[model samples]
Target: MPIINLNGPKLSTAKKKELVKRFTEVASEVIELPEEAIIVEINEMPPENVGVGGELLSEKEDK
Candidate 1:
């Protein structure tokens, strides 16, 4: 079994579903595993809890 974990900002349910589908296809092809044997987990984080270039995402967005 293959597990794929993705961490990013929150997204719509449709977007999440698309990601899972696309990721599964690519991962299955690359790893030579069946789609049924692959798992995709999406971890979403709030802007306050995520940072970039020494600034919090929320703070940067305020600029």
Candidate 2:
């Protein structure tokens, strides 16, 4: 069994499952692990959780 932790921006529920499926499919080929045995954890973060160019990734500018 493989445990994969994925972190990224907010995603829809369907998209989340799609990501898991895709990850599982691609990883299973190389790791020799069953798709069912793979565990994927998606950690969706709000814009504020990320930053860029010395600024928070909010909807508005930091300055």
Give me the candidate number with maximum lDDT. 1
Model 1 residue 39 CA deviation (Å) reads 0.5
Global lDDT of each candidate:
0.95, 0.85
Candidate 1 C-alpha lDDT tens digits along 1-63: 799999999999999999999999999999998999999999999999998999999999899
Q: What is the lDDT of residue 49 in candidate 2?
A: 78
Q: Candidate 1: where is the Cα deviation over 4 Å? A: none
User: What 10-residue stretch in candidate 2 is worst by lDDT?
Assistant: 54-63
For model 2, residues 1-63, the per-residue Cα lDDT tens digits are 689998788899999989998999988988987888899999988879777777677845454
Model 1 accuracy (lDDT, Cα): 0.95
Show how many residue pairs clash in every candidate, following the order shown.
0, 0
Model 1 residue 8 CA deviation (Å) reads 0.5
